[model samples]
Every structure is written in structure tokens, then in C-alpha cells.
Target: MIDVYLLSGFLGSGKTSLLSHIIEQFKKEGTKPAVIMNELGKLPFDSRAVEADVPLKEMLEGCICCTGSEKMEAQLQMLLEGESFDVLLIETTGAAHPVEAMDAVYSPLFASKLNMKGIITVADCKRWLDRDKMTPQTRMLFLEQIRHAHLIVANKIDLLTDSEIATVTMQLQALNAKAPIIQTSNSKLPLNIMKKIEATFHEKEINETAIGKQLFLSSRLHTFQEPVNQEDFECWLKELPDTVYRMKGYVPLVGHKNPLLFQYAYGMVQWLPEMIKMPPQIVIIGDQVDRIDVLGRISND
Candidate 1:
């Protein structure tokens, strides 16, 4: 399986800058890394962010968790099936929730296609403190991104002082105690720290993931289970709120021997015949999603 890393942060949090450093470090080590950038608007900002020579793909015209989720799956498949690489990195939009965007990889279409590493969220130590004053939507989205990530990269520390940096670290630590937080300036960090990241799905924490937190797994687990009503499943998916940026799951249909596949783009729903060997598990990564209720509905349906 391929190792996929999701990079997210608020506006000007220096996600692209940090990602650029990662790619450069890999090149220095003679490793090739593939990158995917999600453009929420028509302009491809991330495409121009890189200075080094590297193979990259950009998904434009939508947020990775919003309009371009399907395209994300397609682009990722193309890279793994058509191209060759050692690692997969995704740089999410400043406005999009990173967790929801990362959830796009949860399909059976990508189960064997690639392996996902922990999420990397870059927090601008200086900007994060005043985020509440800049805008509420951004504040909410940034908080959501921080909650779901397995690694918190407290970047842009150059602009902050000793006390300010300490405050931000304490706040993030209070919010999430499990994930380790790293300090960086313009993405300048040790490669060994990132290489140490395990690319496996940890179900206990993932199943308990909040809708806003992006899903970061630590293992590869697949299963098969009983049938569910296709109609109710669709309804449930459609009823989800806009904050639900991404949702993915595997379910057996009533009549077919194959599993009835499920993947959602926030409120958008899609189902198809899945021949892959997958379990009854579904992973929902988005903004403000009800994990237990969603799991219960899938099981009852």
C-alpha cells in the first residue's frame, strides 16, 4: 500500500510551504514523492507554490471535501495505477476541512490502491491566536482540521514570541492529547520525524472520530457483513449537513452477493457494485458529523 499524507491548515498557515520542504527533503534523500492539491476555486494556487521540480497533480474547481471529491478519487487512482511514486501528499484548501478531504481515500477503490499516513495540519502560531477575530467560518474550519489530524505541525513560529508559542502549544495540547505536535518555520523540519510516522488505520480512534476531524488510520482492515436497505442508505446520506465534507463505507446489498458500496460528497451520495473483499465498516470524515448515529443507521438499514 502507498503512504498518503493529508496536509491542512488555516489561510496562510504555511501548509504549502511545509509540504514543499517535505518534497525537497525527500529529493535530497533520492526518493520520489507524488503530490495532489485540491483547489477550491478556479485558480490553482498550490500549483504555483512549489519551486523544486517534482511530479504533481492539481484538482481544481472545487474543494477536496466539497465539489471535487470524486475527482480526488480518480486522480489518486491515476497516480497509483498509471504512475509510480514512493509517497502521496495532499494539500487541502484553506477553506476546506482537511479531515473531510482525507476521507475521500476511504473507498474500496483505494483500499488496496494505497496506504494512508497520518494527517499533517500546519498551524500558523501567530495567526492561529487571532483567528477568532479574523473570521468565524475560518476559526471553525481550522479548529475542525486540528481536531482530526494525527500530527499537529505548529508552523510559522518565526512570527511569534516565546510566550505566544507556549500559549498555542498548550491550547492545541488541551484540544488533542494523543497526537504529537511539531514546531516549524516555513515547513523547515527534520525528515526523520516524518519518516517515523506510521501509515496504518487505528479503528478505535477512527470509529470515535468527530465529523469535523479528518480520519487518520494506522492499519489495513477489511470485512464483509449482512445486507442493508439501499433506499434508506441513500436517504441518510442525502440528509447529511453541508459540513459533512466526506463519508465512505462498505455495505452488502439485499439481493446481490457483492457489497453495496457507499461514498458521499457532503450531501451528495453514490452507490455501486463493489466486488472487493471489504468489511461492514464505514469511515465518515467531515465537519460536524454524527459518527455514532451514522454507524447505527448503516447497521440498522
Candidate 2:
């Protein structure tokens, strides 16, 4: 049976970073792995950043736990039949609830063909602590992502002091007393930990009420024709409306020769230089955001 690992976490929790590391290790061991990236936005960002040689299938425009499950299953079927891989990794969107994602895995079609090695949940130390500041639905979604994991990876520990680290460890323990907690910065962890055999599914522990609630969230994608002034765009990103939860895409800057990749989560914003030439486009995921207003603001000179 193929070993399948489900990597679940909140937005910006370093899931992709961790996945890259896992893929590199697999390469060293002469094992080929397949990746299934579940993205909440229509335009892919995290998948593009991942450096892997294996075949990658993207489930975009919706979370795999809900509307995208059928597509995900079809992709998995194709991978299993057409390719030879030692392991399969499913990287879920930050907003995905573990219970629902697992349900897709336990479906009749896939349950017999693959063995779930473990459910690894990556938790951003800072964001996990401040989750209460978000809306009720988002806060619950964050908690539910951790509740069912066999391993809870408390990432971004480098950002915390020793005292802060201890406090965060205690908080994670309170939230998930059963799962083993591993702390790391930049989502780094020992390869042996992932290879260890562990119990994969916990159907009895799933909270049925939380399974279908995330579908209420809204998402919109917008494209811009002109390059934006770097300073002006940064200022606007900093003051984005509270309704916007996650924003990411590629943008061309006024003076820079190459376009830049941008990602914004809550109050944090990051811009990285890119070599590829792609049209200026962005995907915004939030609740009740006005599409026309967002387009006007982004298109402003």
C-alpha cells in the first residue's frame, strides 16, 4: 500500500516550506513522491514556490474538503494508475478543516488503495495564539485544523523568545493534549519523524457539525493591466479592509524589471522578486469583500 500523508495548517503556517524539505529528503532516499496541493485561491501561489521534481496536481478555486473533493479524487486516481510513487502528500489550504479533508481520504474509492501514515498539522506560533482576534467562524476553523492531527507541528518558533516559546508550547498542549508536539523554525524537522509509522485516521473523534461550515466563506480573483508603484502598493496592502483574510498573487512594479510575488495574511505582507513573466493578478479570500471596490483600489495610479 502507498503511504499517504496529509499536511494541514492555517494560512502562512509554512506547509509548503515543510513540504519542500520532505520532498528533498525523499529524493535523497531514492523515493519518488507525488503532491496534491489544495489551494483556496484561483491563482496558484504556494505550489509555484515549492521546489520538487515529482508530479504535482493542483486543486484550485476551492478547498479540497468541500467542492473540490471530487476533482481531488480523480487526480489521485490518475496519479496512482499512471505514476510510480513511494508516497503521496496532500497539502491542504489553511482554512481547511481536518475532519472534512480526512473524510475525502476515507472515501470508498481511496480507502483500500492507500494507507494514511499520519495527519500532520503545522501551526503558526503567533497566529495560533491570536486566533481569538479573528471572526468566530475563522477562529473555529483554525482550532478544528489542529484538533484531529496525529502530529502538531508548532512552527515559526524562531520568532519567539525562550519564555514565549514555553508559553506557546503550553497553549498548544491545552488545545491538543493527545498529539505529539514538535517545535521548529522555518518548518524544519527531522526526516525520521515523518518516516515513523503512526496511526492515521481517527473517525470516532471527528466533530460532524464542523465538517460543512467552511463553505460559507467567499473568494474572488482580480487581474491588473498596469504595473503598480511599489511604495503605494505596500501602503495599500497594509491598510487592507478587515474583511480580507488572505491575499496573494503576482504583480509588476513600476520601476523593477521583473515582477514580484506578493502574499498577505492578516496584518503581515511579503514581496519577493520573481524571474518569471506573468500577468499581474491576485486572488483574495475573505468574507463579503466588495469586488468592484477592491479592483478600483488596486488599479489606482
Candidate 3:
């Protein structure tokens, strides 16, 4: 059985850094590990930062817990058929629900071949303490990520004092009393923690109840045939409908010789200097997003 490890955490919570360290450890032991990185947007930044020598898979434009679950299963099937690896590491998007992602792994297609080792959640101490600053929906997602973790890594402890760390630990314990919490800096935890016996994947009644009440999240990929007006695009993005939670893609700006990578989340837009020659396409994810309205606003026409 191919051992599967699901790493869940919020955006900027140090999931990527922890994943890199895990990959290195596996390599040092002479075991090949496959990586699957999920992103809310189509433009994948973290996947590229992982070690190039290791096999990697990108699940983009949606979270595996909801919209990307089917695609995730299909990708896993492909990977199992095409490659030979000792373990599979799935790094879910910050917005993902671990229950949903774990449910996907227990599907009949992978029931026999894949063994879920456990869910390791990495949380930034400061971020966890400041979750009230986020929107209700965003905050719910953040909390839910920790709800089902087998182990909780309270990372960035160096950012807190003894008193603050105590408070953070208490908060995490309140949220999840069962999972053992490991306080660490730089997202590092004892290697033995990862080697623990695989957690039992019980088919809880709540899983069935939640399946019907799952949120509606969909993605739309918009392709631009001509270069887009940078200034106009910025204005449009700033005024995007609240339904659009995340937007990212490659865009050929009017003046730029190469296409630029654009990322938008929680009302913030960032244009990375990284350039690519691929066709201009942007993926937008949200609930009930109107593609026609999005096309009208984003198109330079």
C-alpha cells in the first residue's frame, strides 16, 4: 500500500516550507516520495518551489475538499498507474476541509492501494490567534482545517512569548482536544511523529451528513485571445463580485513582452514578475460565479 499523508493548513501558514523539509527527509532515507500540491487558483507558485528532482502533481483552480475532489482522485489514479513511489504527500489548499479530502482518499477506487497515514495540520500561532480578523466564511475554513487533524503543528512559536505560546496552545487544545499538539518553529516537527501508526479512517456518520450539505464551489477558466489592458484589468479585479473568492492566471499585459502571473485573494491582487509564454488564461473560483459577468469585466474589449 502507498502511504498517503495529507498536510492541511491555511494560506501562508508554512505548509510549503514543512512539505519541502519532509521531501528532503524522505530523500535522505533513499525513499521516493510523490507530492500533490493543491491551489485555489490556476497559477501554481508553491509547486514550482518544491524540489525539482522529486515527482510532483499540481491540483489547481480548486480545493480538493469540494470542487477538486474528483479531479484529485483521477490524478491519483494516473499517478499510481504511471509511477512507483513509496509514499504520497498531498498538500491541500488552505481553504480545504480535511474531512472531505480524506473522504476522497477512502473512495473505492483507491481503497486498497492507498493507505492514509494521517492528516498533519500546520497552523501559524499568530494567525490562529488573529483569525477573528478574517471574514466569517474564511475563518470557518481555517478552523475546519484543524478539526480533523491527527497531529497539529503549532508553527512559528518563535513569534510568540511564553505567555502567548501558552495561550495559543490552550486555544488549539480547545479546538481539538484529541490531537497531540507539537509546538515548533519553521514548521519542523520530530520525524518520529510522522512515522506513527496510520490513523484509522472510520466512516463517521458525520461524513455522510456533511456530504449533502457541502458548499457549492465552482471554477471557470477564462482565456484571453489578445493582450489585456493592465490598468483596466486592475480596476476590474478591484471591483470583482464578492462571490469570487480567488482568481489567478497568466495574463499577457498590453506592454509586457511575456505574460505575467496574477493572483487575487481576499480583496488583494498581486502580479508576480515571473513571466511565461503560455496562452493567457485565468481561473476564478467561488460560489455561483457568473461567467458572463466575469468575462465582460475581465475582457479588454
RMSD values, in order shown:
16.0, 2.4, 4.9
Scored by lDDT, model 1 comes in at 0.66
Give the per-residue Cα lDDT of candidate 3 at 64.
78
Task: List candidate 1 segments past 4 Å from native.
Answer: 51-53, 199-301
Error of 3 at 286 (Å): 9.4
Candidate No. with top TM-score: 2
lDDT of 2 by residue, 99-188 (tens): 678667666777778998878989888886677776777767777778777888899888788998899899888877878889998888
Residue pairs with backbone atoms closer than 3 Å in model 3 (clashes): none
- The per-model lDDT (C-alpha) reads 0.66, 0.78, 0.76
Tens digits of per-residue lDDT, candidate 3, 1-301, equal 9899999876667788789888888888888999888887667766865887777889876667666768888888888998889999999876677877777666788888988888999987877777777555666767877767888999989988999999999989998887889998888876677878367546333332121144444566778888878888888877776556667677888878877887765456778765548657877766556553765655554
TM-score of each: 0.65, 0.91, 0.71
How many clashes in each candidate? 14, 0, 0
Off by over 4 Å in 3: 203-301
Please give the TM-score that candidate 1 achieves against the real structure: 0.65
